[model samples]
Each structure stands twice: as C-alpha cells, then as structure tokens.
Target: MSSKEVDVQQVLNTVGEPTRFRIIELLSSRPHAVGEVATALGALQPQITKHLQALEAAGVIRVHRLGRRRVARLDRETLARVAAYLGGLARADEDDAALDDYQRAIAREETRLAEGDSTRVLRFERDLPADARSVWEAWTNPARAAQWWAPRHFSVRVFDFEPRAGASIRIVLAEGDAEYESRGHVERVGAGRLVFSLAPVDPAGEPLFEARHDLVVTGEDRAHVRLDIEISAVREDAAPAVAGLRPGWEQLLDALDAFLRTTP
Candidate 1:
C-alpha cells in the first residue's frame, strides 16, 4: 500500500528468469543502451529489448532518454527498498545464499573495467523527492553535507568548508581506523550548482591525483529535484580509485535522501 512496500512474489518472479537476471548484472556498473545490452547478452535486439522493458516496467531498471539514445540503468533506490523489506523479514538464509551470486555478478563488471574499459569520467543522475532549495542547503551547509557526503559505511569530518568560488574545502573521510584527507578549492558556486577541484593527499600532503566534482540541482516540480553528479580528471593509473565512484556516490545519494526524508 505504501511506496516502500513491494510485492515479494513479483520481485522473485521477475528476477527468476536467467536472462533478466543477467541483464540486471550487466547494468550494475553503468547504463546501457538497448543495442549495448543486446551485444552484452549476445541475444537478438528484440529479445533484449523485451527483457529490458519487462525489467523497466517492474521498476527494477529505469529506461530514460539520454540525448538521442534510450539507456537502461539499475534503479538502486527501488532495489534498496526491496532489500530493506527482505532484511526486515530476517531472511538470513536467503541473504547468505545470495552473497556468492551477488559477488559473481559484480565481478563480471569489474573484469570488464579492468580489461581496458576504464571510464574517464563517472556520471550519475537521480531525481530526489525533495525541493531544490533543500537539496542545495544539504550540499552546501557544512553540517548537513557532513551527514551524507561520505559513503554509507563511512563518515566525514569537514575541517574547513566555504561554499564559495575560490574558497577552501577540506574534509577527512574515515572508515573504521583508516582516514584519508581530501583538499580542494571551490571553483564555481551558484544557487543550484557547484563545481570544485579535489585531490587526496598522502601523509606528506602530496597530491595523489587531480580530480573535479561538479553537481547540479534542478527543481523538477514543487516537491522534487533532479540532481546530476559528475566526477572527472581521473588519472589513468588512478582508474581504480574512480572505478567504485559510481556505487560510492549512489550510496551517498541514498544517505542524502534518507537525511532529507527524516528531516522533512
């Protein structure tokens, strides 16, 4: 009856098909066009299209027009919703059994990326059920930003934050006993968008790699905002760092959504 409640049987039935499950695995890293999906699955275009459409209709995959191409990407929030439901039911046996399958699915994408399929830039776009102003405040305000800037399992400490062009922005990301300091300067700052250059530093304060993060927020309607996050300037050798950027940011965005949902 609620947005978060999903038909468990429906999810099980939809993912039961081997082809659909494989399609979901293929999209774990990045979005794929219909042709790309066909090539990845070695199936005919029409067949893959039908599978994708089914997944899209089931809310597991989202199909959107990116420029002239229709691309399908995993709807992580929807997946997370279902995962939360399953976890709440205390399905430990099923969860334990799924660990291996999940790892294998992720390994397929990692293999592809390792074999010279490195991406120069990582991009993500999501529509949040929050206003642009709230989203902007959550990003620019130091305390709010600290709440969700790091990945789900990590925490962030904002040492120096000035959300203005040419101002300093420094943060320490802590995961357990390990910590990394990132230093950067804000390049451009506006009402709904912000751009900055960031780099991780060693103990000696030497830069690891130069990177840039650009975020744009668009007011979609009275109660929704579309946010675009892009990371670039990733060095070739540092490809591994950005490799997990997609899922890293996805979890952070989920954190942001949770923050907003509770705060509102």
Candidate 2:
C-alpha cells in the first residue's frame, strides 16, 4: 500500500479489541467462514462477524462471498508488510546500539592518546583457505600483496618489497586524488612469522610516524592457514597515525580473504 493510504492508527484500533484480535488469530491459520470462526473461538456468530468486518475495513483481512457463504482470510501481503516494518525497527535499535559502542571506543582511545600513551597496539586474525606456503607467498610477493594490501575501496602499489630481515619495504596507497606512502624494514623473518616496522612519509621521503608490525602464520591444515597481524605505535606522536589502524587492517584482511577466494 502507498504510505499516504496507510492508516496505522486505524489498523491498531481495529486489532485492539480482544474479540477482533482473536478473530484475526483464528483467520491467520486458514480461511474460515463466519460460522466456522465463531465455532472455533466459541464466540457468538454475530460478534465474530462484526469483528471480521472491522478487520476487513482496516485492511488486515480479506473477505469474499464464497458461493452462498462468506469466507475470511488474513491478508498475507499486509501482514508481511507489518512484519517487515517491525523487523526494520529492531534493526534500527541494533544499529543505534552499535553506533553507541563505537563512539565509546573512540572516546576511550582519544583519552588514552591524549594522556600520552606512546604505545598503541592493534591486532587482527583470520583463517583463509590457503596453505602456509601459499599464504606466505601471498604475504611476501609484492604483486600479490598489492592486490589485497589496502582497504576494499583503495588501491595499492608496491615500490619495493623484500621479505628478508633488514630488507627495505615501500608501498603507495591511493584513493581518488590522495596518496599515502610508507617505508619500513623487515625486522625479523622466519618460516611462520615476520616482524617489521613502517613510517608514513611525505612525497619528499620525510618520515611522518613510526609503527612496528608483527605477522604470524600458522598452518591450520593442509589446505588452510591462520594469519595474525599486530601493529604497535613506536612513539607518542604516532598515536594519530595508529588511531585508525584496527579498522584499516581489518579492511585489508577482508580484502585478502576475498582475493584468496577468487585467486585459485
């Protein structure tokens, strides 16, 4: 029904009466004649018929003359619309609660940063359908890393990537007209884990902030592996750069998951 034609108050009032509500409940099970409804609900035939009329007028039920008898049935489409409206209300409440939680987290983080907490740590873990060797390759391969290193909406370019310890790493991220670049060194490397650090830099190669990152890969099975990534701020001034680290890593990991699903 059109929004303008929806009389919510009228619908509520029509169903507010106990007798009418009972009749609607009865009709909900199946179509029934007035006499049948009266018999099922132990209601007087005249009273049940009047209740059905009110419900029909409110568009809650449909009545038709079936041969010599009148039959009534709940309007499935209207009931579905009402159900969807109630579901939307429930979803709205959930969204509001989640938003409140996010705001509180942001406030707490801001307070911590303002208090000069030089070390901020963020971690992410995910299981992907790739073996340890393949996962390792994806992480260490510059081209494969570029395919999923950035967030869902951003693009990434690898300037130089060397996974060996003490090797240099540089990456460029682009979104629209904006570009973000970071350079770092692989601190340590092993078969299952790697440690590194990155400093956001300007176009002239000036360091903006510093972060230490640790990545661990564990084989879950012959065909799957679990990856853990942790990033920590190395300086008090790095707080601002690391503030958005959690979600940024999450988005990157999510993109990686998507890539693995489609890669092979």
The best candidate by TM-score is 2
TM-score of each: 0.53, 0.55
Model 1 poorest 10 in a row by lDDT = 222-231
| Clashing pairs in model 2, backbone N/Cα/C closer than 3 A | none
The local distance difference test score of each candidate is 0.74, 0.74
- Candidate 2 lDDT, tens digit per residue, 1-264? 764565767887888899888887888778998899999989788888788888998889999997989999998777677767767767756446544755666666667767766554565677877777777778888778878889755787555888789999888888888888899899988877878887777668866556777788887553343334444443444444555566667677778778877896
lDDT of 2 at 22: 85
Candidate 1 accuracy as TM-score: 0.53
Residue range 112-140, candidate 1, lDDT tens digits: 55675533455667777678888888888
- Model 1, which residues run further than 4 Å from truth? 1-119, 220-239
Q: How accurate is candidate 1 locally (lDDT)?
A: 0.74
